[model samples]
Target: MQNRRLFLGSVAATAAVAGLSACTSMGGFSLTEAVRRLLQLSANRAFDRLLQPEGFWDDQVTRLALPDMVGNGRGDVLARILTGPMFKDRLAHAFNRTAARAARNAAPAVAEAVRGIGIRNALALLHGRPDEATTYLRGEMAGRLIDVMLPEFGDALHTASDPLIGEVMAALTGVNTAALANDLAVKADDAIWRAIGQEEAAIRADPRSTNDPVLIGALSVR
Candidate 1:
């Protein structure tokens, strides 16, 4: 009776070990899947925000107010004449309103790209430095968006019945579109850096995980 009981106990222990191994393997797979989903979701969210009006305006961090190209103060004067004493305020508000509407209009294309790109590359980006992911996604999508938005924006600007608004856009026309776009791009980049700094600080303050080794290594190299 004793020997028989021993054999049964051994058998039970072996079965338990096998079950544990399977569970561990499954857990690892789940973690990988979760990481992938997070990346896709985060990337999509960032891109969608970029094309949104709030993304362009409400966030003073990413607002697209261009400097007066006509001259310092002169641009302000021009804005006033065209838009009235409230010209600067109105122009800024209109730019934000229009950009937000336009972003909503461009959302479909952003969605399509998220679905089409496999999750691996984007996941790697999320694990990377702060703006790395944004830069990659922007590079992938911006050209296509520009192709669509430029003509639409131009048409909208042209049809703007407000003479003051028309004059401001006309002044902008004399400047190179590429230069203006670059200025906007720089501001966006600055915003990303600010975000990254905030995120890094939050991570460091927590008593939980250590700083990301990968990010640490990259910073050392830099």
Candidate 2:
């Protein structure tokens, strides 16, 4: 009896709070299946929230910083000027808003990727950390997402920002919109993945927060 109790305690202590794994069976609440569901739930919830109006801009967790061409507020005179009240309009519409809008198109790719995730060693990953699933997704899609969305985002950025803004950015950064887009793509990916991680953490802490059976089953103990 004592040995059984100790084994159960150890298993409970080491079980991952939440995660995903590779499999397709709809059987009982095995750890592997639960992990996979948590992953998909986190990804879908994060993306859905981001697809809303001003979703990226209003949510600090997912809001992206200004494009590299725009410069930070400290040393660069142009960057400082752009940070002033006069340029708030340009900055707001050009970056975060654009990212929020772009998420609509980018989401389909992300969803497809999420669906394709087949974590062959779900047992190992599920035992690591609550965010292991999100980390996996980021590694799998970060660069590919940047590549897939760059043109779309570049076009959106060009459309959102005025011609004068682009000219000023080019003058300061010596990079065209296409070049600037690479940096933006990276930032956007970081923000989105961060949002996914946040959702995973939230669900892990309180499975009831999501009302998803898989997430609740996977993480309720934690």
- Candidate lDDT values, in order: 0.48, 0.68
Every model's TM-score? 0.52, 0.75
- What is candidate 2's lDDT per residue for 1-222, written digit by digit as tens? 999999998775554332222222223455655666777788788988888778887788887776645664233556555767756555655577667766776777777877677676655655557688789877877577677667767786565455645545544554566767787777778888888888888777787877666556555443
Residue 1, model 2: lDDT of 100
In terms of TM-score, how similar is model 2 to the real structure? Answer: 0.75
Best by lDDT: 2
- Scanning candidate 1 in windows of ten residues, the lowest lDDT window is 213-222
lDDT of 1 by residue, 95-132 (tens): 55555555554456545654554444423454455445
Instruction: State the RMSD for candidate 2.
Output: 4.8
